[model samples]
Target: MDGETALDALQNLTSAAGTNYSIDKNSDLGDMYFNMTNYVGDTLKMMCMMRSHHMLTDVVLQAGSEQFHAHKLVLASASPYFKAMFTGGLKECDMSHVKLQGVCPTTLARILQFMYTGIIRVTEVTVCQLLPAATMFQVPDIINACCVFLERQLDPSNVIGIANFAEQHGCKELHEKANQFIEQHFTQICQEEEFFQLSAMQLVALVKKDALNVQDEQDVYQAVLQWVKYDEENRRPKMEHILQAVRCQYLTPAFLSKQMKSCDLLKKLPQCRKYLAQIFKDMTLHKKPCVKERTPNTPRVIYIAGGYLRYSLDILEAFNADDKTWTQLAKLTVPRSGLGGAFLKGMFYAVGGRNNAPGSSYDSDWVDRYHPVLDQWRPCSPMTTPRNRVGVAVMDGYLYAVGGSSGSDYHSSVERYEPDEDRWTLVRPMQYKRLGVGVAVVNRMLYAMGGYDGINRLNSAESYHPENDEWTPISPMHVARSGAGVATLNNCVYVVGGYDGSKQLNSVECYDTEKDTWEFRAPIRISRSALSLTVLDGKLYAMGGYDGTSFLSIVEVYDPTKDVWEEGEPLTSGRSGHASAVSFHQCVIHCDQHEHSLSTESSLGWCSTRPSSTLSALAGSALNGAVPEPRTSGVGAVSNSLSAPGRGLPDGSGPSLPYGP
Candidate 1:
């Protein structure tokens, strides 16, 4: 009784004293909290001194014949395998030396270094070996670093190898990434050696996945035949199973007969033969064939819309840049010239223009929009003003039909079209009325520059800010221009040749929107009006205009960096007053007067000429010599693309043409 009472009394006294001290006293533990990272880092840095330090090392890691003196605790903490071995009372943990027979000494060193200092250097070449070792050692950080290194180097040739490696190692994330890469590049992977190296079961599993992103059945068939040929005797037995994975129904009869039918692999496969017969039957029955996948993201088809050649016209067509061929599309509702065109949301807005038939000229307010997917034109809301010779521009998701004219009257009234609303709203009028205006967007502001004001061709330039619906007069261009072509590139708005009241001017001017300044750049080689100026691949293209003599079908391209113009691909047929715009490729719409004509084909063709230039490639020919024709430039300077010897039709499926239609 006495002992228990004494212990309770002691405990109660201590508790009361502690409570009083906390309530009655003020204390400062520290003013600022400090990090111990530097101290800890320095201590770890000393531990990583592999060549000099051996004091606390408890074990030797022997990879190959080389040995690394390391601490058990450090290795154990970094790897589950090492942790289990060291802490689970394994017999190897008691040994002074641990031998890793399958590991490379260099990779083991790098892995240990990473475990100690959180740093490792891995490359695509070295990671191939290092990844396996890291996986074996159960070192996740080194494994992750090696995986990342391999992924960055993944390409058509090596992606399959990496994917196979990732799958073998049970790396779920890496396997998923490799699968995606394989899908995106399946066509190219067919050309890789590793693709042919995959086993029959692996190939079947791979190709049979509905997620295979092959452009055509041909690609899959090619891959299968190549794989089978690598060891025909063994793979031949499984040909029927593998051919089932090939979407032979997606292949055309011609492809099946010409490419696949001749192959022994396809001839022997009963499943493939049945699929081909069904495909031919579907073709004969006029059933909708597989919608061939288009080239990804790149618009291989250039849509050609209305323009005047011999009357106000309403013809529409699309030119295939890939195959260098043209196919006519649905016609527009109205025959119009001076087409106000802009591309938005995969549709071409054919805005206001002037109607031309037998003896009459009428201003047209009809807005027919072309939908590529539907291959048809539907009427959108007409502009507030009926204008011909108008300038069309897109800025901030709005279509702007700037200054043009209503019959003989010039217009300064600016109308903005919103696609979502299917309506046009009048914006601030320009400072000067203009017809045949060259309008472009720079820095999200609509710039209306060169145009005629009925009595005088205007050089006065103004900028329209959409945010405030305000028009501010900027510096006037160096020359008065009307019926000129305008384009924007590399942050500058360029105005090319136009009639300057008295003469057809060839002078080119550039306006820097950021600097709010205008400077006369290099003049184009030829003087022409009613031409088109466009930017493709960061370069300016000027084509097809009246040279105060006759209409031109010649095309020219300007190198802004070099301040010079060179000849581009000449249009198959000469045209003027035409409208052209850049898509994934450049397109030109014929717009000549009712009485004049190209005297030949009605279709517009495309070339694969890249518009960008290497300023260092100063060896370009000028083609500045004048031609015999009144409107033709000597060199046929500006147009979209001209990939000589490699020009294909728009379909991209046909054999390449010889630089001509």
Candidate 2:
């Protein structure tokens, strides 16, 4: 008891018999009092039902034509609003019926049901109608519950309505939740008609985030254009304002050539033309489009392992092709020269390189894994044969180490490393004992391409079927390239520049997997052998290699869309004979400098001009294993571009409630 209550009790006892008698302390009295209250609750429930059976109805909540007969005490106890009106000297206390405003009778019935049963079926159809009534009655618990139900129903189709409704009614939690959902799914959500329904200020706020989950400002362009096209007569006045937010410099050239060049909206808005001019000027100066970052998914990363610069070194590095930056990773356990690597299930496996020390079996069979999360390498079982210059590819959940040299011995033997089993088994040997062969995965099969069979540079290529445990011969390339780099893009295997026995080669050939034929495309801008190749951001990359006499730090990118290859930002430190694999991370470091630079103005801002964008979507960026469908006339599927940040939630309410926000 509080001090005031104790003092009052003493005063009351002063006049009682035996004033000095001690008081009895009963901790178990709580359960007794609870039982007594339960009896009172049962009586109250009985009274609440008396009016239902037409026994003694003192109050009626008149909802529409239906009159709900109820006792004043039950109604007052259940709702504070009812308590104020019925017992607080209001005329309604004496009245037979009280009509509720701004809420349907059915909704009121549901509220009453919750008061009695402590549960209500919350549905999308009813939550909207129920929230306002719950708020009016000061039912914060019910308000919080209904808000949660509304949040789970949020999607591209209804989030805008929910956001606006929640804000207007002061449902702060719901408003915050819906707005957060919009930001995380801006790319896909903006494509929805519901997103276009946002007020001018709301849309502006959403489009102006440095960390928007879109690839570039061009996505912002497409989103704004679609919104304008919904109702050009009304939206045209805001065109310049909206388009001004879009950074034209970040748009693909295909969009510039086919769509922006023919835009009627651009001609009408001179300010938008200025935006385009700035992009062109920047490009002329070779300044990359200043986007703060990509958000739709974890950015695809390039992991480089084992290369030769002045000397062979066991160096590990990561190249983010998008931002054109590089990060040095954990070095191999032992220095390995010409070791091959592959990214499998979120880890980098560096295998089969010549040990830094000179000796027999200097071709170390040891295999070590670089866990990106742990930021360190741990040893796994070694290969069946000690070899260097092996080409590693993942197929059917196993890493296939293709042809490479063991000391002076050229190996046609191919082996598969099973991650789950932590074991390596020799697969069917290749048809040819070739050293320095390149391997890539295309169409679910492992293709081992050009290499030296010790006697001569071999143009012959073979495909390994993991299911059958066999190698099937495929058509040969037009030229021989030992120590070549290989990649699969657009359903074809591309063999880049390599040694042709006579000299370093510059010609590039793409093999049609379906046709089983090799066709020449454009040659590399520079002739290099022993380079690393991988596809990133829907473009082919040939990076860091020796071009006959000198080690090259050159970075070349090929756009199959434009049928050309231009220079990209070079690696921070380039070395030849490096093994390259497509790993994944949040963003690529800019290759030119290690600086984390992003443009503020052009990156993200309110759109105040007509945006320039192609009506068609481009092929979505690649994911783990498969290439996406070609981009046609509109934006493609939700690319694996942005990933959300980590946050913790409260217990039992599920992952979404207090966390994963």
Candidate 3:
């Protein structure tokens, strides 16, 4: 049962069996077994055969001459590790679990030397053989010993083998350690000529993992270019591979310029110039004027629709020109609704809404798609969960739906849908649950703005980056509100009217993404929640919604440049809960009239019939009587803040007045 007693008994058995003992002469077993060197070799070979038979046959031999004889047979043909293990005085190691049975005798002997003396002599051939044996034996110290011996031997010629070994062993840390060693010692291996010899897949993996330093990246770029320039037949397919690597690394402008110069060197190659141009086309950042003069007779109407309403559809529309005529595009199929919608490429998507009842309904799953070119609507894939008042936007051609309310419960789940694939994949949930949220996209990033989180309205904003599939907090809005319409105009997001927890608001706030700040602007003429705001012809327009008691027909325009709001012509009919879109020449409004019909006498009675004079009278009143003294209380309070170049009216006409009631 004791270690020393077990070894002494095994040695006695091997010595009595006429086995050479010199194999164990220099080991601890010899010192413990009374200097049995006379039988060391024979004892070692006998133990090796016994171990091999035990490993292959799963049989245990009695601790006597019979076991010693079986081990001798195994040692004659066993692997070096096994031979080393047997001769190194390992009298009783459990050999039944040995995995590598094909190792050679000489290799096994060296392993035995290491096992006995804790020193391994590694050469090119033995290094490979010992590494696997060390791992198989579960001897970490020996494995590290092998690694140290191999580290000094690594050069440009052997880096590929080291990398392969590291990968095979699933030792990422070791792989990195080996890679660093190779990078330091074998610079020529990463040179242009040498690097080009690597497979494209390997190059891509290296760049993607950011495994290369600046010097290595430059070397790789140069080598890839050289191959493409001089060895066209072999490197033609590698052009795309190189470009992908460059993009992943986000090479500096200087490096890109160098790449461009190298591209010129491949001028004679087929489609080389075209390929280079395609890689740079509209992908790199470009600087240009924000607004360009519109060509004469060009149509610039943009349409937006889809949200929730109570008992009817609530569509909001805004026009772009001086004509501030807000129209009801269409009503929803139901009413008492709060929902989310997005414009993806050319198709407009609307989804999710809740009713007045405490619970959400499957009716929220109604998904409508509108094509601008054909001016029509069709059904598309519905969301997995019937949520109300969700945040939706498109980034990188994928649509993301953020937190919303399912029934009365608030959810923080986020889902992404790919239209081309017609599939939705769940993503990491947001930190907060929100409903009636505002969503916008800027610089390819999606922003979820102010919304209600059930308990109170939210002013905090968060942005999601698809590259990492993560969200980061941004500047919060000045005031918390839900059902606020949001739109990106001139690279800044404008949060229009929405209902605060207490009341509907007309206050407009603009968020500067670059500055990460928010500033108040001209409030719309009417305070409304669940209204829609849109940009047309470079102007911000607030369209129809309920003021709280009844649906509104008034439309207002905010000149961001001037920081002033002016009333415009009203919708043709007095109906709220409608969707709006910028049409060819006007703001096309759609009214959801499932509950309230346009033919209803009461609806017709509330329609505004005032002429254009209504605008002039209101302007005159605002400019003279209602205009506040230069105190910090009214429009004049921030007069100095209105420093933008005044909006140039159509045909250079002055600001037009609204027709009188």
Candidate 4:
């Protein structure tokens, strides 16, 4: 009949059937159907409108000069603080007007709006005030929103205050993120006034961390001195406690001499002078004094995989940058050079490469996974194509293999591996075949750059989008380079030293993905090719490679902000065609009785090349004849047996320390 009559009929049927119906449409159990798509939104909006008009408002929340009218049931359901006040045996349960202490009127108004509308605006002006009120009221969503906002706003100038605030408010994740920012920007943060405001213990705690991203230990010393100078009269008395954070052993002899001669503070403290004297004496005697704690160069262990020195080598060496020491790990399953290495989900994967022996054509399609906790290796699914000098990266939980050669011919094909499924599948190929390519991932896009085609060394580059399975060309380099070391930092992709057609080139280039442009950066001192590059603690470590005339053991570190390069300790020996990955594991100098051997075969039908005695020999060379220590070998054994430097073992089996974090 009419629209109103039809609507009345449906409502009558619905009222007879009840609010939630179970009618069978096919059986024609009911003649009417009803639904409200925006029922929740409408009901909440009506409640908000009623409160705004002060209609049937049951309670008044007073904060300073401001007051808000709200329903007790709505407020109680939205926040635990209000729920406890209304439902628990609190006096406010019966009170019509409740006054809130320690809350700003404006912030209280925002909280009331969020409680009614499920939305709130957090700005720089309001966040500081709103966070505490939200935390006090136990509104988790607003608390998280405030934390996320603060995390994004962190910078060198304000990070210290943000970190302190996060700690005070018990925001664990935000505090950790802010602390990480402090460590990453320590050099810049030292120049800020907020850093000078830190307490002595807080200053000591920041500087003592091995992960502090200072290019030179001298910076750390200067930072501590500056902190003390900020309030010399009061802080001078605490100098001894703060100075412990400076690794005196790492300061250069020249810097120490300069400071001792010019600084009046060093002249006043006998203990500081004595400590400096002892360090100088140790330096003169060529004795590296042991720091009680294991403070490595970076917090993570840098694992150098197979490489070619004279011939292809299977040696796996772990380098601790802080102590400038190397410890030999178990030998690789195969002798592989020109391989690609990466860490995915706490495991290190060594990808395709060739056994570069003279007169050999043994290119490999293997993928070996190392369990950091177990200190053992197991094979994953091999790639569909054999690759040497392959460029590899991980993005979106999948490992990607870029262009490489197969000994006889170069390839333009690319493949992706799924770790959980143990499957390898081919994706779109690149525009040109390349060997000695440098591949990196930035903003989830994989980039392949600088490799040798059959006829010439190529300066071209391309990027792959996994979502569309497509490859797009990008800007070419200034000159052709093959075997360049590539890494990404601060959304910029850097390509380091590689070989041109005539000679080894030390020129470096950085590409900004946002701008799609390239610029020259400070190059390594040594001209090299086939070097391994990885980022650790906000610095780029360019490991051993070949310098055309000879295999080189040089390790140069790049500070991007300063645009300068500094030489770190060299590798144990000259190497080329090596691979590097940062892992959270450290290895003991000696093997345990229950150590898992590399001889075991995986279900995918891959096993170690052979049980080599060369591993022991290499271990002897790396570690100076230290006696073996016994450890129970398993994942659980790691936490119990991994001792810090100078900490005695639980069973009193050995006194020597392991070489990892």
Model 4 TM-score is 0.47
Candidate 3 has a TM-score of 0.44
Best by TM-score: 2
TM-scores across all candidates? Answer: 0.47, 0.49, 0.44, 0.47
Error of 4 at 658 (Å): 44
lDDT of 3 at 559: 83
Top-lDDT candidate index: 4
Residue 177 miss distance in model 3 (angstroms)? 67
Across residues 1-661, which tens digit of lDDT does each residue of candidate 3 receive? 4545555666677657764433324465555334455544655544444343343344233322222213433432334544566556675355543333545556655655444334567665566667776665455666777676655554444455566675675546566666764443333455423344556676566544333322223444565566465666776766765655543232333344455666555555545555545544422432222323222232344443443223333443433343433334443333324455666544566665543322222225445555432334555566677666566776556777777665456767788787767677888776678766777777656788877676777899988765566888998898988777788888789998887766778889999988889999888878887666676766776766656655665678778789888886665544433344443321123335323121111212222442223211211211011221221111100112211222211111011102100
Report how far residue 661 has shifted in candidate 3, in Å: 35
- Candidate 4 lDDT over 254-282, as tens digits, reads 56767777788877777877777777656
Q: Mind giving the per-residue lDDT tens digits that candidate 1 earns over 599-632?
A: 1111121113321232111112101212212211
Q: What is the alpha-carbon lDDT of model 2 when measured against the actual structure?
A: 0.67
What 10-residue stretch in candidate 4 is worst by lDDT?
Answer: 648-657
In model 4, pairs of residues that clash are 296-322, 297-321, 297-322
Which portions of model 3 show Cα errors greater than 4 Å? 1-298, 302-310, 314-336, 355-363, 372-375, 574-661
Error of 1 at 99 (Å): 24
Ranking by TM-score: 2, 4, 1, 3
From the highest lDDT down, the ranking of the candidates is: 4, 2, 1, 3
